[model samples]
Every structure is written in C-alpha cells, then in structure tokens.
Target: MKEITPNNTNTTNNSKPMQQRKRKADTLGYDLNLATSSGGETAEKGGDGPQRRLWVKDRSKDWWDKYNSADCPDDEFRKAFQMGKQTFDTICDELSASVAKENTMLRDAVPVKQRVAVCIYRLATGESLRLVSKKFGLGISTCHKLVLEVCSAIKDVLMPKYLQWPNHESMSVISDEFETLSGIPNVVGSMHTTHIPIIAPKVNVAAYFNKRLTDKKQKTCYSVTIQGVVNANGVFTDVCIGWPGSMPDDQVLEKSALSQRADGGLLKGVWIVGGCGYPLTDWVLVPYSQPHLTWTQHAFNEKIDEILKVSKDAFSRLKGRWSCLQKRTEMKLQDLPVVLGACCVLHNICELRDEPVEPDLVNEVVDDDDDEMVVPEVALRSEFASKARDTMAHNLLHHNHAGTSIL
Candidate 1:
C-alpha cells in the first residue's frame, strides 16, 4: 500500500489564496458584488466504513448579500458587528492568513471576511447558533467551529499588536494622566472585575457558582470572572480572565499574572487604583475603607474614585459592545476564555480607533456590587507603602495635588 505523503496527496486537495478563489456568489461579508455566479461539484466517496449521501446543502445567504452589497451601511454594520467597516477590514486582513483554510473536496474553504463576520455578529447579537447558521448560510456546527477558530486566530495574531503592557515611555504618560485625573502618583492603570454568565458545568459545578451575585440579583447564577486593568484612555493593558466567579477580588488579584509581575518588583513605586474591593497596598491604591471617614479620607475617596471610574467604564463598554458577554452565552464552558480574550483585545482596538458604541447599546451585563473591602491576600505593603496612603490622604486634603480644595 502506498503511504500518505505530501507529494502523494491529490492535486485538488489544496488550499488557495482568497484572491485566486474568489467566485461570483462567494461574497460572504466582503463588500464585493462583482457579479452573481454559482457552481456545484461532487466529492469522492469516503473510506468504506459506511456509505452515505453527499454532505452539501442548499442554504441561501440572502441577508449577507443584500446588506453587504454596498460598503454596508456604516451605522447598520456597526450595530450588527460592533465595529465599523474599517475595523472589520483590519481584522479580516490580519487574520486571513491564519483563518483561511484549504479547499476541501466537499466544499470551498470559508472566506476570511465571512468567518470574522460570523464570529463578530454572534458576539455582538448573542443570538443562538441556529439563527447564526441561518444568517450566514452555514451549518450550526460550522458557525460554532468558526467562532472558536477565528477567536484563536485573534488571540494568536492580533493580541500582541493590540493588547500589551505599556513601554516605559507609555507608562510614564499613563502615570501623568492618572496624576492629573486624581492626586495619585505613579498610577499606571485602574482595575476592575466583571462577570460573564455561563451554563453550569456538570462537574465541580459548585466552584463556578456566583453566590454573591445570585443572592443579590435573586437569580441562580454561574459565571467566570474577567479582571481588567485599563489605562486612562480606557484601553485594557492587562486582563486575567476565566477565573471561577466565586473568588474574591483579592484572591483573583493574588492569582493573576499581574500579581506575579508585581512580585518581581515590576509594580514597585507605582499604583493601580481600584474600588473598595481591593485592599490598599504599595501598588494598589484603593479608597479608604473605614467605617467612619476623616475629612482627609473623604477627600481621598472622592478623588481616587475618579481613577476607579476609568476601569469600571471600560468594562461596561466591554460588555456593552460584545453583547455575548452581557448575558448567558451559547459557547461551551471550556471555549469561553478564548472568546473573552478575543473580546478584550477587540475592545482595545475599537477604543484606540475611537469607535463609538451605538446609541442603543447598553450594558446588559450586571455590574458587581461594591467591593467588600477585601484585604490584601498577603503582606504586600512595606513601610513606605503603609505610609504612602497617609501621605496621599494628607496631600489630597491640603496640598495642590488636588484640583480644588473642599474646605
């Protein structure tokens, strides 16, 4: 028997550049309405395990052809995909090489633009896969498979370009903006945690239960957490996603790669302001959590809150733009991390490009309650960090560090 080798493979079993493979009816999401054409082909019968009929079906993708006929109405496109045409083009261009597949005997490889559109629209609308399948003229299984495929490409290809830790110069600029926003010095980012609802897993179901959220919202809930640190301009710089929702904010912080970086002195002398959910530390400058606040503490909370709002608003837009994260999703439990990571990366891109959320877009995902004043999971404060809060409070109350004096 001849062994299967690359050179021995059939000539027809090969991938082609999209430019070379473009056909008349091949317009999936691309704005190419060159002309209308269609063709059909037969596939070789598979191995003789069991004989079956050919597997291609006739599904009409009229919706894509109609709306995608022109450049696609800018407002309408953004509403459907959560991004404008330019942003969509950029994603398709970047992920094409990675997402484009080889022509199969049974069907042509899904087009790059269509693959991205399917995933983005599903995420933006949170519609069921059945609907997505009907909309894109693909099998339900195909739509689900493409979502994960394109998401993996985004994480691999676009993440490094769009999402990153700032350079030294960028960090200095971030610190300056934070200082101007609040009296906090050397603060590079604002941090917040948001939750995404997921279907309960069969095993270890209790771990994923969000008791705090369930108790407060009066709905049985299961979720995974996404902890984001955003810069002054509301772009995510770092994210720790997919932790069990039951963990406290401090515990999530303790387990993050960001925390590990801090342990290596990466966070020395800098602060990332967060809500009361985080205990004040050398690097984490949270608001005063005292039962009774002094005048200075009151002033400090008011000012520092300005920084925390940056983080909260960033996550709010994240859930708003990617409606899939706003509610229970059809994605499987194991596949959510890739999906959420893609959303964060895309969020940064949309923000950097100055894309505005649609006027009707609202944050459907419920925000977490006020942080419980969780203490630092470990002794992360030094003598300098311990005194840093007092000095910051006094300065906020009495010095020019504050924008205006309350007294």
Candidate 2:
C-alpha cells in the first residue's frame, strides 16, 4: 500500500431525476445511499406521504451553533467531535483555502467550520452517511461529497505540516528521548503494522482477503494494512497505508515507499525498532527470534517490547479517538486511504495538543505482526545490524541499565 494521495471525486448525485450515473454500479458492495438525497431544499422521497425539509433547520443548528463557537464550553462537544474548539479552528484555518467556497445565487456553500465538523464527526462516530446527513442537516450525497473533499484537503493541506519525518535537529531529540525511555541508543522511532477491516470488493477479492485473520476468527474477513513509525512521544514520523491485507508485515515493508527512503540512505546510521516479523536490516532492528535466548538477548527483547508498546498504544489511542478506523466503512476501496490519512493527521493533532481520549472508548488493539518468524537470508540479515544489536544488548546488562528484578 502507498501513503496518502489526492484522488478524483465525482459527486454528481443531485436532486434531479434518476440518471444513469446515480444508479449503483455492479461492483458496489454496500448500500451507502441507493436512497440518497437529490439535494433540493424541498425534496421528499419514499413510503407514506411527503417528508419535506429532510433533516434540516432543527438538529443541524442546535448541534452546530453551540459546538462550532470559539469557546466549546462542553466536554460533550469534544465527545461529539474528537477535538477542542481551538483545535477545530486550527484545522479549519489550515484547510480553509482548499475547502472554502463562495456563496452562489441559488444557495450558500458550506462554511469551512461546518464542512470540517461534518467530516470529523462522521469519522469520530463511524456513523452511516445517512446518519451523518441527519446530524449535520445535509443531503446524504452532499455529506459523502464533503467527506471526500475534506479528506482530500487534509491530505493536501495539513498532512505535510502534521505528519512528516523529523528534521536533523528533531531526529536528535527523538533519538535521545527513545534512548532514555528504553535504554537503547541511536533509536529514533518504533514501527508497527496493523490492518483496517474493509468491505470486500467484487474485483480482486483474494488480494484483499485476510487469511490469517479470517482463520483466527473462523469467518471470512478482509482488510488493508497500515504501517506506521512513531517517535518516543507517540507521534507518527512516517507511514505506509492501503496495502493488501493478505501481505505480511515484511512484504508490506518491502513494497512501501519507506523502504525506498531507507534504500536511498535516508536511514543510514540510525535504527528503527520493529517486531520479529521484520528482517534485521542495517537500519531496522527487530527482536531475536531464537527460542533459547541468552540473558543479554532476553534483556534486549524486553527493552524492544517497551519501544513496541509506544507504537501499540499510539494505534489504540488512534482507533479509540476516531472510531471509523475500528470498523469496516462504506467508503469506496479506492478512497479509503485518503480518509485513513485524515484520521492519522487528526490523531497527530490530538496527541500534539494533549487531547485525552475517553477511557471507555479505548479498544484493545490486536496487531498480528508476530505471526511469522523470520529465518533471515544473508541479504535480509545484515552483519552490521547483528553486531549493533549485540553491542546494545551487552551494554544494557553490563552498564546496569537492564531491568534489575526478574523475580
């Protein structure tokens, strides 16, 4: 899978009569909105008599006017949308130029605040597009359009500022912090790979099939992978998203743009700690896979677990804060990456601003990264990495930095 990239959106589902484009495609697997709106102010559809002014003028303002203000005044508001009012404003300000539109003679364009709110609320709650329309007082099709638009804006506007590799100076700070936390030197980041469930596409079903997860659950399942690298503070420094779910962590890493960066010598001297699933490359250090480990090796593995927890806890908070990542979304398989990228950017903002996730919302993240044991070939297992791991392990025990009490 590749990282976030802008894609085209066709939001032509208007209030006009049924057209060919409005009809569902053969491959469409979900019922997001076969009953979607036509967007006219007085439009009505289905069943009994007329239903005028669908989901407008009542729930929308009471929900919007209060929470959309400069002073949020309620943690309830934060629950509704994942971030504070100020943080909301900051995102709006950053994405204003991209998402903002001028009022037309026929109707008003969605303001930046409302647009951003609609998008984030949909993601934070994982509600259906129909429910999102009702909550925001928008047309179902319009809600879908706004979501796609805002996600594109976040990827184009906010991602570079919020989710990017550290500069040389920042890398030094991250390395020092990681060393302090895990007693390992020259380790700037902790890496983990996790999968997000998705509705199986009619085309390429087998490519997206998660055989390992499906067998574990005893039912058919599908997903796409997300590989993330986090600093000591649990902020993302790099990411590879939207790979096929069937691919293991090592294959996913090999296919990622991150490996290209490493190949280009971006990670020549430093190490990023990963699980045993990854090969022991010169720039990547993984736990020892041998069963009969020495005391020094065992000590190294324990410290490596400490680093892995940073990535694990970050993902838990990420999925906990924005629930959309936790379940299969009705979004198109092609468009999933943009929305996932938006969630990652928002997660970074929340972590940077010290926004606390509601305790009850936290879900147990089960990453099956260690499903495969590495029997590394010579090319995969670098001599340099082996020596570096040994040196770090010996220092941890001899220098009194090892965990003292095994009892």
**Best candidate (score: lDDT):** 2
Give each prediction's root-mean-square deviation over alpha carbons: 9.6, 9.5
Q: Can you write out model 1's per-residue Cα lDDT over 17-54, one digit (the tens) per residue?
A: 33344442243422232222252222233564332222
Model 2 TM-score on a 0 to 1 scale: 0.84
Candidate 1: pairs in clash: none
C-alpha lDDT of candidate 2 relative to the true structure: 0.80
lDDT of 2 by residue, 176-209 (tens): 9999998999998999988899988878989999
Q: How high a TM-score does candidate 1 get?
A: 0.84
Clashes of each: 0, 2
In model 2, what are the clashing residue pairs, if there are any? Answer: 1-243, 15-38
Q: What lDDT is reached at residue 170 by model 1?
A: 93
